[model samples]
Target: MSLDVTSPPVLSDVEELVPSRYAVRIGEIDVLVISDGVLPLPTKMLGHNVDQRARAAWLNDMFLPPDAFDWALNTVVVRNGRQTILIDTGLGMDPALNLPRAGQLVKRLKAAGIDLGSVTDVVLTHMHMDHVGGLIVDGVKEQLRPDLKIHVAVAEVKFWESPDFSRVDMPPGFPDALRAAAKHFRKEYESQLQLFDEEYEVVPGVIVTRTGGHTPGHSVVRVASGKDRLMFAGDAVFAVGFEHPEWHNGFEHDPEEAVRVRVRLLRELAETGALLAATHMPFPSVGHVAIEGDVFRWVPVFWDY
Candidate 1:
């Protein structure tokens, strides 16, 4: 019942017409944001608590289709000293969802010149299918180093035992799919998991902290090097979150707490002027959070071409 691990043939990242990767340097640390591709979902998934008209209007203002749109699936690779850490693996080969555009992380990593065995650590924000699916993809586990460590919050591992779905508002079969992915991912990678209670310092400047919102164990990774800082906020903040922090995303397991977590992270990013990157934002999803009175704004960094 887990994700269909049967992966399709690999496609070279060069064959794709559009760019699939972007690199950023955080002081002394090297960061790479790769596009796992995009997932198409209904606009209603953006905010199930509000009226459909409001959601539609917001999408229309952004020049997006009202009915459905593609949400970017972004994953990060961080390298500091001798350690190379992968933030989150994108959606990987979920045939049932018919999501062809996503699950491209494996091949893209190759194109980025990153060998799987070089990944010393993987810090997962949560166990959502889209985040951990790539680890279970066909031929992926065999390529990774046997000593690879996957750092996940202890709360995250416990929550999946009997995950609560009553609070989520996902599409027809998504809940089941998510549950299966989490279960299988845990079973397959149990021995390699380095469970942390609240916070873990993967390396000197890279830290993973549990924020617990979108899911009971949801966490965020903060990278600090010299005077530069970047936050891999996971699902704590979304693109629509800047203008409508109060609106509830359908995937939130605890919408009320999710709003609190989202606002808090946004405030920290805005006040400290740290760069922010999230999973479901635009391709690179690299930007800054700006505050005007009570409203928050997303200011994307100029592409470092």
Candidate 2:
């Protein structure tokens, strides 16, 4: 069943096409955030905190337009010793989503001198369409990595696999493909799926920590090599606004819990002085947390790429 490329799949025009840089080294581990494209969301999706008037003010201050928000889709690749692991697959070849190059992750992986078959594991923070879309290629029998172990949070697996989600009021104007994607998540990727509880170590230096609330079983991975530590914060913080550490994204399943987790994580990152590689902050989304006058800011690292 090859993914149809001619027609718009479900979530069209949301994935980006601009090619971006690919690799960063953190201590002994090498990290890469590959571009799966970008999504253009209405500025209102940012949040309701800013009224239309405040929205205009904020956009003007940023020197950006007040109408829409362009957010990047980043898929992380972590390498240690002979092991290569990917966290989250980007939007797949979903024509409805308007992503022609949705399944370029494998291509990018190859460009990085890595092979999909060599990947030991693929950890998903949650089962959201964007995050898991690349796991399986449309119309293709084999997944992006046929041999790799696929891991997801137990709670997240349960949520996506359950029929109850249909009862919840979805976001306004949610796409039909997204709804269908949620329904078929389990049926499509159950063969290699491995569910974990709160915390578990996938490798000696790579640990999966529970940071739910965003999606019931949302989790983050911490990579430690020697004295250096870095966290792959997947959708925990979307943009620079997360710099506040108290603000939560509107799409979060449980906003209150999301904020609590964000605060605690930011505090921990600050205290540990660990590097943070955000999936959606910006291109080459690697940075550090800095506390200033009771507010936290994301200090993006300078990449020579």
Candidate 3:
């Protein structure tokens, strides 16, 4: 169902604790990376290598100073002309997940000068809890933006909504809340969601491209205007080094396929020189991909705004 942008969704009693920040603007497109909050992930969950000495040395080399690994939950907001689009909503309130700063998306949206009612579309890169948690409020009957149209990948929708997922054993150390949330997303809200295959455009210049592996039907968004372009590469690549062109995350559903797609995307971005926006890469998670010998490097661009 399509939603009216002028009077979209209403977020009642929701408070915004953190202020919004703009990443950078490329031409007419103003991109803002809003924070939902932060998450503490076990360092070992990032990859498979478990050797203590090797892990410590790698951490020291990478300058990831002590303590538990903290991940910033960043959602990308793109504005072009009259259209305002949000890619991947942040983690909403769920006590089970132990996310203290959850349900902060609407506040950040407002801080970015984007009325929840003005959001034209919400393109979900996948059905993971972190990506779709903000789509609906916990106790509210309707969505945050009841009038907004939600675009989702066909494969992702099928997998998450399918009955088979219930039978699959939860991976060791996977949070129970996240697993439950994924199941709820599949059963409760699958009808209101719009599914797209391969490539589809939400408006004129905002396009969705299929980039599977992380999730069965995962995808990425490419926003363009004139000569400038930015690729909102959801979880296609995680952390800075995951963009190594050959590296794949251990959290991926299919590591081999994930690596293959990562390599292909790196080459494509390198050849085209498009701006890269990763959900898990540092704050404002936007940058440019550069080829360094056999591997690729992330060159972050700070927004002057």
Candidate 4:
């Protein structure tokens, strides 16, 4: 065998790797962290008051690209013996905004052994495109379940439905997208719409609470069984949102109010030591935020591989 050094080395076949979808239990409720995909966000777009030099330095220190950051779009599924509840619908079937990297929620849900039609309820954290986009595909409703009920904050519905929404100047396609989503929500899911004004139980164990300012009705879903708890914070925080809770991002409808909501929530989460999952924190974006003096730090859940 030593004399066979003349033989060429063989190559192995290429392997395609995908991001892992994870499941963690919040007491008796089964929670599955599903991946929709990612959006490469510019750091500048993330914060209006973020110091350029400091942000760049932090990104460099973290070995991240100075110009861009990969924002993860994570959605959650909560299952009990009888009910299947979806936290947020990831970017749906829209072609214009559906980048190749995104629009994978349906496939990933199936991969996770969840039937599309088995989803009994969809809780829209807010009416943002990424959250509501997956509700409709190709101008037709992406029926998760024929009898599926849809829940949204009352303020959120009113915000997008108002004629004044059309009058307000927004980015070229943004207003149009909002109009389209509102139309679909009103027309297709009208009877299915369950509007809430404040914290209310969607079912016995799952609840929705308004966390506004990211939008008029931006909210979070809290699922608890026994003493275990997990909060699905939709766009409530980004990768750096917890670290720099004061920095205002462009995506927020009201930067000042957004900061206020974040600060109060961070403090409460810090005190309770409850687990958190955000849409743009990181894949399987589950963790806890620890309070350190005046600022909070992200403590990612350790993967026990």
- Could you say which candidate leads in TM-score? 1
> What RMSD value applies to candidate 4?
4.6
Rank candidates by lDDT, best first: 1, 4, 2, 3
lDDT by residue (tens digit), candidate 2, 134-211:
765664335346666878888887766553333223345444665566556667768878879998888888888779
Estimated TM-score per prediction? 0.95, 0.84, 0.84, 0.88
Question: Residue 191 of candidate 1: its Cα lDDT?
Answer: 98
lDDT of 2: 0.72
lDDT of each: 0.93, 0.72, 0.70, 0.78
The TM-score ranking, best first, is: 1, 4, 2, 3
> How many pairs of residues collide in model 2?
18
lDDT of 4 by residue, 100-206 (tens): 77767877776777887888888999987778767675533564566888889998888777634422334346556666766775776788888899887888889
How far residue 287's Cα lies from its native spot in candidate 1, in Å, is: 0.9
lDDT of 3 by residue, 1-305 (tens): 86658774564554443344556676678777787777676565455433545555656767995445677777888888778888988877677556685567766776666777777778888877778787655653253456667788788777764423332233444546656667776565656677888888987778998888777788999988889888888877766454343444545676667778777777778779988877777777777888877778777775564
Candidate 3 accuracy as lDDT: 0.70
lDDT of the structure predicted as candidate 4: 0.78
Q: What are the runs in model 4 whose C-alpha is more than 4 Å off?
A: 1-16, 138-143, 163-175
Q: How close is each model in CA RMSD to the real structure?
A: 6.8, 7.4, 8.7, 4.6
**Ranking 2 against 4 by TM-score, winner:** 4
